[model samples]
Target: MAPSSNLLNTQIDDIVKTVLEDATGDVYMVNPSRDAIEDFVSVATADDDDLPTVHMLADERTLKDVMDDFIVASNAADLIDAGRLELRTIEEAPENSLLVTDDAVVAIVHAADRVGGLVADDEEFVSATVETYAGRWDDAEPFSLRTPPITRVRNTLSEEISPEAEDDFTTILGSLETARGDGDGLDEVTISLLFAARNEALLYDISKWGEDVGIASKATFSRTKTKLEDMGLIDTEKVPIDVGRPRLRLKIGDERLADADNGQLATVAQSMLN
Candidate 1:
């Protein structure tokens, strides 16, 4: 296959901006990175009611930085905030690069080193790619409520717990569990909630953790979150984004849990259980 003479002269970023700006109904992308999606995010969030719904599919390794960039872009008011944007991870590497809007297939990123691939409006290729994208979208998890990355949490725990004794280690974990527990016990729902807050996940993700743990249904996640709030175990703060209302971020409310040291278990248990 031969490259388009026109694409040889075009810059990658410019092509991305053009594709995103030209989108009307929806946007479908495969194997996108932070730099690849920057312009698309800007164009998608520009309008309030009319923003195109975006669905991105990529390998698990790339999802973290993509999510980080989305967070930053949403904060900067460059994308729609009403959950219009969604992401999913695929186990297999994409066979071909694709960027599709409702109207056309704007770009294909074939090789990592190449500046660009075929950029065209071939009717057959666009139709086939769009069909492929729809299947991937249906199977992807909701990034808003997706599990917090294990690597991020591991890094945090490693920094805090190194050079510690067995007793101190027990105390740190015990304190966290006690803070999330009530007079009854630390059930799965409670434990899951604590895990999310300890990792400083957003409220959306915390609720999903409940569902992931089989807490009756998705609605129960919200009820569980409210229960935690009422118990003074967790707190929420609104972070402004591009559209609708600001997103709520979850945090551990108890100082005993935050401190995570000797005597923390007793301190939190007394307040939380009593």
Candidate 2:
């Protein structure tokens, strides 16, 4: 890619890749979109040999958007834990987005139809951009993410519980990514209940596992289970226990749910929810 003072009509991911490829040291990103950050992390994580440290300053809203999605949040957390990424938040973000590196400075351009960027390699421009954003990076507040690494969650679920549950959990995550809205998407707890229902697992066992893994509290899982039951998506049957109350075994309630495969379960449940 040639150095351009003017915006080029190209994909944001491509521009990010080009700029990152030329970077000599650490990079600074100013107010990148969720998609841009995803692209950046994808490139950074893919390259095992040279993982340059990335300093990101984004708005609180954009950070929340990233954190709300299980897959994105978990991936970002993994990078942070590995010291490959540093994420921070600001109260208000500047109008333009930028990626500053020793090699060049790329200004992210948002068009009505697509995203683009302007790459500048002039010494003075690159130096000034770096100085300004580096200062902002120092002043910004660091973001603390609570989501666990996805690899850990997947491995633990498969090891501690059943592999079938882990597979269903992954399928539901894929579905939720393309789902319409926040309310329309099934959350972590709901997905856990769906997994338990699919496997006919005991509620106490799944909820306890969830709490232990830092996914959610047992009470939270119970509430979601009740909500799912009321929505006719799942049914619970009592199993006799030697001690106090009987344990509940989860099962698919609706005929549609029972018939749907793991891939279609989230879609069917979302339709029912709507």
Candidate 3:
């Protein structure tokens, strides 16, 4: 899509790129919806080194919605730590969504099912909009995201475990955008089990590592493991440890999963899941 199109044919990504292309300094995004935030963040972070800093002010509910998606939340946290993005939470829902730069303002328009943008460069309108949102940004409380950066997760997993496991992790993440609770896709726990089965890793080790890295709880991992096993996507063997209970080692239970590569594991698993 052309960045110049600001009519009904334009989407959020087009507007974001158009505004960022001419941005002089920091850009302020006011009250973008969850979908708008996803589009903006994906575009901004794709080549963040050249883009100006972005300050986003959204309501608590929107912030929470972004945080619930693992991919966006992790990427946003990475950008926040790198000083490329800033986030703040407002109390009430906003009436308008806007992208404000020093000299121009892009008003995001939502009509029925279509979305577009209107760029305004008039000094009076730009100044008023910037000033109003600048005050709101100053007063809004900072929103914190607890999800670890995906880069760190991948790096630490490679260092702490086998490279094969990390490879599977990366491939699984690449296969989907969100990690959990979208209803149409597999969740993090399911992904973890599939990767563990791919590597024939001990359930205790994978679950422990997952918990330590804040992916999910061990009990949740156990439940997910049982569910996958029942679905025939994963099978486990009792590994006799000279300790409390014999730990289970995960393996691919079906020929389809066993033959699929790391990149295809998530797709194969999702098909089985459905």
Candidate 4:
């Protein structure tokens, strides 16, 4: 296919912007296929550029993609080594090519300003460092992954948060991302009090979740329970064993939220700090 001069120019502009004030040496740009990475790494260091560098990566999370990417990179190793490609240039770039630096995030916000991406949408898990690389299309579904809203705290939670709780929230999200559904996740008071109220997913008349995980009040607990209900992650009518009245029993959603989570995980993994 003929290169779309317009599209190519725009992408080049974006990539160049990524090489801000860092000490100039060599830089490498990579897309998320192992074959592309290997191919790039092979000829990459020798290619004419303002910088001499090798960027190596192919995001094949699945066994098959991994194998394919590895094959090409390995085959081309001789080419890369001969070029004296700077190891720094060869830093791993996941196929997503996501780079999440404060600068990158700001750039994304600025470019997407027209799209109303301005809303406070950073996940607790996403650092100020922000970068995005193209996601590989799945051979099966041909879909790209994304960081979902639930994982990120709205700007409302950004302020007055203790560093400790912030750390707490971040850790929980990390676990939640990998913890497979028992097909049976629970929204206990601990979840309702901290993440819900703090992240503004739920607004209780009173939110002291950061202080107590057990949750001492019934009235306030009920309010947040309803909030989770609105989100559809929990059922309000379960549990006859311990309560005279129907108590809100927390539960995970079937697939929608889970899919959302996976998307976000992809973004986070891709955006990891090198």
Which model scores highest in lDDT? 3
- Model 1, C-alpha of 62: deviation from truth (Å): 1.4
RMSD of each: 15.6, 2.6, 2.8, 20.2
Give the alpha carbon lDDT tens digit for every residue of 54-73 in model 3: 89988888789778888788
- Which runs of model 1 end up more than 4 angstroms from their true locations? 1-6, 43-51, 69-73, 76-80, 110-114, 145-274
* Model 1 per-residue lDDT tens digits across residues 203-266: 6654544344323255766677788888888777888889878877767778766675445534
lDDT tens string, model 2, 1-274? Answer: 3344545777877877777666778889888988887777667666766656889998888888767766677777778878878989966677788888876887898879877787788888888878888888888898888878777778888987899889988887777663223775777778888888999999999998889877789999999899999989999999999999999999999999999998888888888888
10 residues in a row with least lDDT, candidate 2: 175-184
What is the per-residue lDDT of model 4 for residues 75-135, given as tens digits with 9 covering 90 to 100?
Answer: 2333343443322221344324332322222111123322111112254423322222222
For candidate 3, the 10 contiguous residues with the lowest summed lDDT are 1-10
Candidate 1 TM-score, C-alpha based: 0.43
Model 3: clashing residue pairs? none
Between candidates 1 and 2, the one scoring higher on lDDT is 2
Residue 10 shift from truth in candidate 3, angstroms: 2.0
User: 2 or 3: which has the higher lDDT?
Assistant: 3
User: How much does candidate 3 score in TM-score?
Assistant: 0.89
Provide TM-scores for the models.
0.43, 0.89, 0.89, 0.22
Clashes of 2: 0
Candidate 2 stretches with Cα past 4 Å from truth are: 1-7, 41-50, 178-181
